[model samples]
Target: MPVHRSGSGTTRRSRLAALGTLLAALSLLLTLPGAATAADSPTAAAKKPARGSATMGMGVIAHDGRGGLPGGTLVAQTEGVDVSSHQGNVNWATLWNSGVRWAYTKATEGTYYTNPYFAQQYNGSYNVGMIRGAYHFATPDTTSGATQANYFVDHGGGWSKDGKTLPGVLDIEWNPYGAQCYGKTQAGMVSWIRDFVNTYKARTGRDAVIYTATSWWTTCTGNNAGFGTTNPLWVARYDTTVGTLPAGWGYYTMWQYTSSGPYVGDHNHFNGALDRVQALANG
Candidate 1:
């Protein structure tokens, strides 16, 4: 499970401190022109839509309920939320009105489980002008990584560089089952992750973002640095501070700060400027 419930007792001021750090880092990244945008592949232009004049912004407001930003500025960082079937019939417009600007809806799990609410959640968010993406709950032990990746892609988990569509994410965290590591050895787990990511790239032409915790990664993959250079790390640390990241990652691409946030579900942060978040959507 994510550290969502661990830091409920953390003070709001402490949380603000953490947010300050994130905002500063993101502001610095924004200064470097084209720093956040990755080089496009040969086929990228054909698949990605033309950039629009309006840029999307995901806002994380203070506790005042007035939607005020961290430093009273609008473009510091992007805010988003991730949802699953558990959050049924989301009032996406209401969420947009409440400062959420992007979303990642759960699409599939293993090869059998698919979120029935995926279309509504994913499309609804996009219809309302929110950048949207889909994620797959990986079950590497149940099947081969390539097989699961294909299943995920076939079932609404593929990505298009449509300026507002983010690349798919692989939610590889603790198994609700008894075996947290999915019954695989350290080396086996690394191999499975590589296979899944490779197949996902071939199918979607975008690197699949990885969502996990440091402790889980260390225990399961022996702190493997294999995905560090290629895949973006979406670290889940629900404390007032982000803990030490998994090995080989100098910084996180996204952070799941809290599940019990002001929003409807797990609240996340895109660790860069508004354009950077939109850049990911462009593949």
Candidate 2:
């Protein structure tokens, strides 16, 4: 069942004492590269994609009193999904009925491919009362991040203040071409990401949401800890646990826990309350 705006417990006591210890440990883990713990490390099991119907949903609260989240643990969260051209002609009304409160859609890919259905998908999401966002499939090897960001913005990746739009996303995961890091060195990859996000922020007045896997980030960017403070981290892990986050982020804002869910595209969770998600959309 989808936890709605009022579902989060209002009377939950503060966990400041426990949070302090966890933050200290996390701070240490993020500083050093390849320092993730064994359990948090992406396991073979983590690679399996999620399987379920639109009726099934998972949230940021993957572990409820059973384990930890990116920032120790959160008291509450909500479930959502992301779509692309791959999921053609989404029934937004049906998705909303299936417990999705928000969604992100692919708007552009590699400065060349704009999602042919972006107009409908992006508008359809909002028409159904779902918070909608736009993301770009990055191709850092073909062109610079700034150039790609501009292309994304020029297409359909821009944001609005209607309180229904989430920040633009930079999807920098597996390389469809050959080189996973887009033929760039680790430092070059980091610089590329900086250029993209910096340009995104300058254009939209908000930092871009970073969608990436832990291993990819580690291998490509040396698990750089720079973006966590500035941008929201959208971590991708397919298993039951989130495992380790990228170096810079203390907690993840979104988790793509499964590529296969009740939805057509990826299943996700917004790791905060409805109002918090609204705030994210508001910005």
Candidate 3:
């Protein structure tokens, strides 16, 4: 059985700290213009969309039996081994068949770092799979976030043929480790976010969506007038119906309501209201 770990108490803060360090490193490396050269450019081969020319319309949220909630159309990167290795272990095929149209595989984290499992799965199936696919980086801090994002673009190699990703997401939550970031204040966090987002957008020319829990959103960038409205928000609220989301967050394109779902190999997951996502993207 997979061991389940809860993000409660001191452990949560500790995890955040470790993740912060990882992200900081990633940001630095990706910010470099020639970090990965040809692979890093957006001109690389693009992957085909799963539903032909028809847009599937829904979104997704992924869980690794942990607290990290990455929103997208297809959710990959469960715990244990990479998705391909445990093909028999997790019923991803079933999930795909059951309306899960895309998969965002975990690509990299902090600078000079990549998820070992993600590397395997991405290299093996990202381009060849029928399900439209993209990769996400577990963003740490500014410098690391840039490096990790760059690494993902460089190594993942390719774009969506239709110019739409399976969905590229930036997993932004409170650092579990609670280590004081160089820029931990609200302004600092917002600046860091801007730096990361701007860098990724410049390189990929794609809108890099922001993924955050209610608390993180409210705490980090709520006060910044420019932060909240500039990018598409993928809000994570595990409980309550989507209808009951906080008043100010109606603009959110996707909601990660249930971490536990049938599609994600029986692990906790999230879903997108096809209509809402389309409306937001179109707007």
**1-283 per-residue lDDT for model 1 (tens digits):** 3465556546666889999999999889877876654443455555432321100111111211122223333335678898887788789988899888889998888887778788899999999999999888887778999999999899998887679999988888766543678899999999999999999999989999998887788889999987888999998776656669999899888887776777587787788877888988896
Query: CA shift at 54, candidate 1, in angstroms?
Result: 36
In each prediction, how many residue pairs overlap at the backbone (N, C-alpha, C within less than 3 A)?
1, 2, 33
TM-scores for all predictions: 0.73, 0.74, 0.55
In model 2, state the lDDT of residue 71: 44
lDDT of 3 by residue, 95-137 (tens): 5455553344555544544444554444333343323334353
C-alpha lDDT of residue 144 in model 1: 93
Q: What is the C-alpha local distance difference test score of each model?
A: 0.78, 0.78, 0.47
Q: Can you give the lDDT of residue 26 in candidate 2?
A: 86
* 134-240: candidate 2 lDDT, tens digit per residue: 98888788789999999999998888888999999998876644556778999999999899999988899988999887878898899999888889989887766
Error of 3 at 170 (Å): 1.1
Candidate 3 has its poorest 10 consecutive residues by lDDT at 49-58
- Judged by whole-model lDDT over C-alpha atoms, candidate 1 comes out at 0.78
